[model samples]
Target chain A: MEENKKTCLHDKHVALGALMSPFGGFDMPIQYEGIIEEHNAVRNACGIFDVSHMGEVFISGPQADAYVNYIFTNDILSVEPGQCLYGMMLHEHGGTVDDLLVYKRNSNDYLLVINASNIDKDVAWIMKNAEGYDVVIDHRSDELGEIAVQGPLAEEIVQKVLGLSLSHLSFYTFGEFTIYGDKPAIISRTGYTGEDGFEIYTDHESTRRLWDELLAAGAKPCGLGCRDTLRFEVGLPLYGDELDDDITPVESGLSMFVKVDKPEFIGREAIIKQKEEGPKKKVVGLEILDRAIARHGAEVLDADDNVIGTVTTGYRGISVDKSIAMALIDARFAARDTQLKVRVRRKVFPAVVIAKKFYKKSYKK
Target chain B: MSKIYYAETHEYIRVEGNEGYVGITDYAQKALGNVVYVDMPEVGDEFEAGDDFGAIESVKAASDLICPASGEVVEVNDALVDNPRLINEDAMKNWIIKISISDEAELDDLMDLEAYEKYLESNPH
Candidate 1:
């Protein structure tokens, strides 16, 4: 078995008496204080997350724009420099390789931030597809660390504590700033949670120092546990769960990010065909009527007890106080207010298909 | 006076004559973080020794509750239904169910407080 990788903040999490667990091949803190406490903190106040395990790859060359457009589903030509667009890299068969963030530094330069677990797979896929293109791909995940400060107070705390004025940075936009005489770093006004926030990328040393200052400045130390809950409450999809080797973004209700009209690109044909005919399966929200929680891999059954689909993600809902889940089922049965049943362990729970966004977001537009 | 006995699975039963109150031990509650919900069996439900009864769910995972002795449940703890965190606050005091013991011989199979403490030390989460 491969040894689990540690983030630069691993020691700091241990010092804070956090409950550590393995996630995406990294030893990450699952919770600090408690899951409910940390989760509520992010919803009400500010919370800091060590997201250094995320992978970063820089692509630059004359053919960078053409190459990225060919491999990515989103239309990068729509965005100018200092902008970020969320999309997915797909297989020729339309299955997702990985969902990622593409930062448009310029027409000829782009930064692709990917999931930690798919770093190796994503790099290999990108390289193999770059045979004819003249782009230079540099995987710089090891050299950078990332921290996300998320909540309603994130903008205020980041500007006051980090001393970086972000009034000019709009949503999904980023800029370079040098901190403490260090190299220029990237800070973006984007996050997975349904709250206003900032994601900072810098050297490992600077990352640790910034974490210390945030904690001292009263930002609650959050872990991956609350991160998942916060994101789920907002209906954001996690890679392995919502989209996988067998599931396309179109089926996951993420067609907004896939530019099917693009003249030429990987998976364009399959995605367009699915879009025209409507995907056979689709992602939907479920509210369990019973107290039992429906979790991932739980089976979805129709009235006759025939399995119709499987749950992608589920929770007891810390903020909403209800048993809710996101499930991928036959498109015909994915309508709102549809009745369904989720087989959770020993019992079958009655559920109703509802809006996936269980909690409304409060982003600062 | 009630005599306390613990099962190897971390459930405890406090016996006073033929009636007993059953709950998870402190060690079990501590191991399973914040308790979000407890699935309790209905009153008048009968179980054999070592039978699966209900379940306890924490934020992370769910665990099945096992009956340590045979009995018919006389009362269920309704308080835990709305506030499962009571188990976390005090596991011993917040018993899950009250039952009239059918087989007193099963008590001989359980460990005393001293032996249960030793068992907890040997097995740590």
Candidate 2:
């Protein structure tokens, strides 16, 4: 078995007595103080996350814009420089390769931020499809470290602690700046949590220094445990849970990100076909009536106890104060207010279909 | 005072006559972090030794509660139904279920408090 990789701040996490666990090939922190405490910190105040495991790839050259649009589901042509668009790279059969953020630096230069687990697969897929296009693909998964400072006070904390002015940057936008005298850094007004936040990418040394400074400034050090809960509550689809090689963006309830109207793109035909024919399964929200948490892989059943779907993610929501889950169920049972059941072990808890967003997103729009 | 015994899986049984109060150990609760829910068996449920009677869910994952002795559940911890954090506060006090031990011989197989502490020392988490 291959040994798990460690980030630059792995020692810091250990020093703080964090619960370390393996995630996406990296030995990452699962929680610092506790999951509930860290989760509440992110929702009520600022929390810092070590997101360096995320992959970064730079696509440049004249064909970068068109090439990105071809591989990605979203229309990159619509976004201007310094703006980032969230979309997925899809297989020809409409299954998701990975959901990612495309930062359009210029007409010919773009940066693609992909999930940590899909780094190798995404880079290989991009290279294989780069056959005729004149695009330079720079895979920088290891060269940089990233951190997300999230919550309502993120803007103030970033400005006060990091010395970065984010008042001008709107949501889903990025700006390049120099840190520690000539070290290039990218700060983006984007995050997975529903709150307003910024993701800062810089060299490993600078990242370590920045992490120390942010911690000193009282930004809570969060881990992947709360990250999952926060994102799930906001209805953000995790790569493995809400999407996979077999699940399409349309079926994941992410059709808004997949621009099928675009004349050409990988999996466009399949996506359009699925859109026309209607999806067989759909990702929806379930509010379990009981406190018993219906976890991932738990069976979702119809009234008659027939298995109809599987839970992708579920939690006893800290902010929402209820048992909620996101499940991929048959499209026939996807409507809101539809009664269902989730078999959480020996017992089946009553559930009702609701809008996927269990918590209102507090983005600084 | 009841005599306490522990299973390798971290469950503890406090024996008082033929009845044993079953709950997870303090180490188990500390390891599990915050307790969000407790899936308890209904009263009168019978279980063989080592059978999973219920589950204790934290914020991140769930762990099954294994029975340390053959028994029939006489009473379930109704307090855990609404607030599972009672275990986290004091695992020894917040018993998950009170069971009538069907086979007292099974108690010989469990570790005493001293032996359980030694076991924890030898097997560090």
Pick by lDDT: which candidate is best? Answer: 2
Among all candidates shown, the one with the greatest DockQ: 2
Q: Clash number for every model? A: 0, 0
* Candidate 1, A1-365: lDDT as tens digits: 99999999999999999889999889999998888888888899999999999999999999999999999999999889999999999988899999999999999899999999899999999999999999999999998999999998888898988788998898899998998786678999999989989999999999999999999888999999889989999999999999998899999999999998788889999898888899999999999997787788999999888999999988889989898999999999999999999997767879999999999998877
Off by over 4 Å in 1: B42-51, B70-74, B99-109
DockQ of 1: 0.46
Tens digits of per-residue lDDT for model 1, B1-125: 99999999999999999998999999999878889878888899999889888889887668889988899999999999888999999999999999899999989999999999998889865
Alpha-carbon RMSD, each predicted model: 1.9, 0.8
Q: Can you write out model 2's per-residue Cα lDDT over A91-196, one digit (the tens) per residue?
A: 9999999999999999989999999999989999999999999989999989999999999878888888767677999999999998878889999999999999
